[model samples]
Target chain A: GIQVEQSPPDLILQEGANSTLRCNFSDSVNNLQWFHQNPWGQLINLFYIPSGTKQNGRLSATTVATERYSLLYISSSQTTDSGVYFCAVEPRDSSYKLIFGSGTRLLVRP
Target chain B: GAGVSQSPSNKVTEKGKDVELRCDPISGHTALYWYRQSLGQGLEFLIYFQGNSAPDKSGLPSDRFSAERTGGSVSTLTIQRTQQEDSAVYLCASSPLAGGIQYFGAGTRLSVL
Candidate 1:
């Protein structure tokens, strides 16, 4: 069982603003992913960066594995971006299950 | 051209009743998982199936819950004598294999009254 902590438990921003969310894990992991839970409760896979950096559209993520931390950046945010963002990781020893972090709730006002 | 698919996007049942949720993973995926999120809670793991081996059911909360993957493809999660605490959004994910990125379905929202 690995521990995951997400910072800035709540965030509020105006449309077109920028924000950054952070995730810290307790141990080594070979599998890591970022997900967005929409208002309808759909879990959308955002990224699968076990390490290094990746970007998609206005969203970018970087994982510093040696430091056991990951950061997700959202640019030009829109009202549609409002939701809960979660980070999940698989500990090196247990590769089958993903341990999820308490998500950061984001709100983008138009 | 398809992601993971879950059936009966929502389920409402009475206490002491049984319910079954189905998930069809993307073709060729070798791993499937079941998870659920209680209201205002983080996602919680339930069970995992990989290939033809013994599933890792360690995450199941109790004997009332069980899941099986057929032919290493579709999966079904059964809850017997469901309780109020079982109300939540049940999510299913599939990965190419263990340690890979998982693709999730829209999830089945269950309400137990």
Candidate 2:
């Protein structure tokens, strides 16, 4: 089984600030995704990046498959961005099961 | 459905009772997954279904838990003789294909007393 660890278990930021969260995996991954769990407990898909980089609005993510690590960036954060951010990955040897990290709890203050 | 849909958004059951949670995946999705998230914890994989077959169920916590899919569109997770530790949010997700981006439902909040 592969292990996934996320850094900065908790984070608090003022609105309009920027932040970066990191995720490290023990093995190579075939698929990786970043999700944001809102206060209501809905897991919203943020990005699907096994490798390389992608950006969507104020959120962006980059995965270095060679290094077995990924970074999620939130820029100009708003109060609504308060919630938990998770990084899940599917190890190359696994078919469809995703190993999830403990996640980074983010709170954007007004 | 536009996305994964879970039934009975919340459920409350007494100890030793049985409960069933339903999930309807997106149209034509070939992969469905079940996950559990406890308070202040991360999600844990429970099972995965590819079409009508489940290839990975190693994540199931105990034999008291089971799940089945019919018509490759709908899935139901059943827990028998539930215990207090069974209380958690059960989440369902689906992907267009195996090992692809997964879309999750709002999840069912289960409380076992």
Candidate 3:
């Protein structure tokens, strides 16, 4: 089984601040996705960057497949951003399954 | 629906009872998946369906857990003889293909007593 570890298990930031979250996996992956679980428990797909960089609004993610790690950046965060951010990966086995990291719990205070 | 839709946002059942949770994936999506998230924990993969057939069910926790897809659209996860450990948020997600971006629905919160 592949292992996925996320750094800064818990994070608290003042509104308008910036933060970075990292995810490291133990094996090569074919797919990597970042998700935001909001207060309502809604899992919102933030990015599907198996590799490379992408940005949406105040959120951006970059994945270095060769390095077996990915980074997510949130700039000028808002109160609504208070939630858990997850990073999941699908290994090369092609089993159509995702193994998720423990997640970085983020709390943005206004 | 515009996105993945799951029914019975919350369910409370006694132990030894059976419960069924429903999920309707986004139209035209070929891959559907079920996951469980225990309190203060990350998501755990349970099963996946490509069309009406499930190719991999290795993630199911026990024989009491089962799931089925119909018409390649709706999926139902049934848990028979539920236990307290089964109390968790069950989430459903859909992807356009086998290994594509997956969008999730608001999960169903299950509580067994």
Candidate 4:
């Protein structure tokens, strides 16, 4: 089974700040996704970057498949972004069952 | 018709009781997954269903956990003789196919007392 590790288990920031979260996997993966679990417990998909980079509004993500690492960036963060960010991956040979990282808990104060 | 939907948004049961959680994936989606998220913890994969083939239950934590998909559309995860350790948010997600982006449901919060 592959192992995924997320950096900065917990993070706190004031509104209008910026931050970056990183995820490292132990094995090659065929699928990678970033998710944000809001206070209401909804796991919202933030990105589906197995490789390359993608951006959606104030959020952006980049995955370097060769390096087995991925990053999620939040620009000018808002209170609405306060939640847990998770990075999940599926190994190349597996049946696409995701292996999740411990996650980075983000708290944004207004 | 839209994103994934889960039933019984919240559930509370005795430690020795059995409980069932249901998930309805988006139409035409061929892949469905079940995951468990504990408080202040990460998502734990539980099961995977693809099309009509037999489900992959490798992620199930114990023998008491089982899931089934009917008509390759809806899925039900049944936990028998649930224990306190089973208390967590049960999340369901669907994707167009394996290795694709997943759309998650709001999740069902289960508490076994």
Candidate that would win on DockQ: 3
TM-score (chain B only), all candidates: 0.97, 0.96, 0.95, 0.96
Better of 1 and 2 by DockQ: 2
Please write out the lDDT profile of model 1 over residues B1-113, one tens digit for every residue. Answer: 28999988999999999999999999999999999988666699999999998999988999999999999999999999999999998999999988788899999999999
Q: Write candidate 1's Cα lDDT for A1-110 as tens digits.
A: 78999988999999999999999999999878999999888889899999999999999999999999999999999999999999999988884799999999999999
After superposition, which runs of candidate 4 have C-alpha atoms over 4 Å from their true positions?
none
Stretches of candidate 3 exceeding 4 Å from the true structure: none
lDDT of 2 by residue, B39-76 (tens): 76668999999976645888899999999998888999
Q: What is the TM-score of each candidate against the true structure?
A: 0.96, 0.97, 0.97, 0.96
Worst 10 residues of 3 chain B by lDDT: B50-59
Q: Candidate 3 on B49-112: residue-level lDDT in tens?
A: 9875645798899999999998888999999999999999999999999989999999999999
Which window of 10 residues has the lowest lDDT sum in candidate 4 chain A? A90-99
Q: Interface root mean square deviation of every model, in Å? A: 1.1, 0.8, 0.7, 0.9
Residue-by-residue lDDT tens digits, candidate 2, A1-110: 89999989999999999999999999988989999999999999999999999999999999999999999999999999999999999988886788999999999999
DockQ for candidate 2, C-alpha atoms: 0.86
Please give the DockQ score of every candidate, comma-separated: 0.80, 0.86, 0.89, 0.84
Ordered by DockQ, highest first, the candidates read 3, 2, 4, 1
| Residue runs of model 1 more than 4 Å from their true location after superposition | none
Candidate 4 chain B lDDT trough over 10 residues, lowest sum = B37-46
Backbone clashes in model 1, listed as residue pairs: none
Q: Would you list the clashing residue pairs of candidate 3?
A: none
